[model samples]
Target: MKGRWLVVPTVAAYATRTLRVPLAGWSLTGEAQGVGPVTRRVYWIDIASPRRPETEVVTHLLQHLPEMIPPVLAAFRRVRRGGGPTGVGDRFTVLMLGVRRGRVQVVEVDPTHFRLQTLRQHSESGWIEFRSEPLVGNSYRLTVVSQVRASSWYDRATYLLGVGILQRMTWESGLRRALKVSGGRKAGHGTTTVEWP
Candidate 1:
């Protein structure tokens, strides 16, 4: 299966493996401080749920967030004018993907940030949180935390120890091109600067 491809060694084979403490979630609260040396705006994010299956919920979100945030904001503005939701819903497929059995919904959004939570279609408390901060340039930091739930035991261990680090390290791969020109009105401090003409 396309999804199972990411499972790799599979949960069954990792049963006997011992896990070392991963430094990722240890940051707790997903508070990212001093994003770039040029500008430090105190960026941070968090994701949490009550059970492990919730971690899968977050994983599904991560797969789609890169595209979802924008249109939702546009739709929100047009909501008062009565416009229908479009590409954005499909764009930010986190809700569509992560939410399997419950009443998945997006709670709020205000320009630079957005929030999503889930609840039982009939019950009231089972939920999860996913938040992100748009950084200088095209950079953003994301964090996911499960209240009581978490991903598979192996997933929890691997993600905490290394995957999170890998995710964070990608910050520089597109830094130069994406930041050719700064974004947002409050530039200078948090934005990245390119020297080419």
Candidate 2:
């Protein structure tokens, strides 16, 4: 890992809310929006590491996704009826505040970018993406973008109040630890923006 990190927060029209929490050497923003049955939210975090290439960073993150994410979110490869394993269609069982199952729908492995999406009927539809940008000097910037959608009001409220916060904290701590172990130092505080629409 190597670069500067920033997180921005945006709010929804119904209720505009902003919260900035400093974690280790990073800033976290949790944003939530609900329009009718579909509620959308995003959690963003960025960091600067010690001049590592984008390809290496993306590969490391994707390969160690389970270790990087919160412990409550359990990820496993999907097995076919024939007893074979499907790599892309993995399953994630979230059990932090509650239990929800989601299946990975997409995976993009590029040098500068990597993305994964999980879809669930009763819980949430989730997307996680990582982008690496070159900065001045020999460093690079790594940005993590997380988007989540909840279908029901109950799920939306739960996510906004409890699950969302826990999720942010988990990622903040997990990422910092991972980066430090990987020989990356935190440059500054990141920003988080919330938006609803």
Candidate 3:
């Protein structure tokens, strides 16, 4: 435990030094770099008459992450190393159950797409992307697609112990938050697909 916490700053420093790149050029979906069995957890919903539109819904999700997520599960706070508008190279420490759980850098963010890549010391390794796009029937859909795998054996053990439940809850609530922010009703029951790819 002490060893894990001590390595955080070292890995964080490395990220600060190397993570500076434009959103267009850094395409680290992190799947190829991940460890263990890779899984893609997708949560999405279709909305009708969206008040915030596609881009606005994506923006709101990134801007107000804590509101959409319960802190006891996970919370995102921008580190002092990152500032200004949420864009590429922005760093955030993921807090879980009030501990320094992991760190991630904003690897990509456009009007409709936002992606985060886990740092070296993080428990899991991968990318989580938030995207909003137009669906058929003139409706819009907001999706959170996480392509990830355990970075270490310890993390894998914990995940099977029930962290997966918290993960599911986080994205499920986030999809609902997107729906509310869009001021639209859910077109149907949403889907949460957990699949190995």
TM-score (all chains, Cα) for each model: 0.29, 0.63, 0.77
In terms of lDDT, model 2 sits at 0.50
The local distance difference test score of each candidate is 0.30, 0.50, 0.74
Q: Could you give candidate 2's per-residue lDDT for residues 1-197 as a string of tens digits? A: 11122111112211222111112222111223222243333333344556556567666766566666656544433323444322345443333433343345435666777666644332455566666666666555666676656635655776766677766676566556545544666655464745445
The parts of candidate 3 lying over 4 Å away from their true place are 1-34, 81-83, 192-197
Q: Superposing every Cα of model 3 onto the true structure, what RMSD results?
A: 6.8
In candidate 1, which residue ranges exceed 4 Å CA deviation? 1-8, 11-105, 118-149, 170-197
Residue-wise C-alpha lDDT for candidate 3, range 1-197, written one tens digit per residue:
98798568536743563334323443343556556788787888889977777998888777776677777778888775544566778777777655435778888889999998987656677988999878887688788888888766666776787778878887878788778888988886455546474
The root-mean-square deviation over C-alpha atoms between each candidate and the true structure, in angstroms, is 16.2, 13.3, 6.8
Candidate rank order under TM-score:
3, 2, 1
Off by over 4 Å in 2: 1-51, 73-94
lDDT of 1 at 99: 18
Query: For candidate 1, lDDT tens digit of each residue in 75-124?
Result: 11111233343222221222211211122245544333334432222011
Tell me how candidate 3 scores on lDDT: 0.74
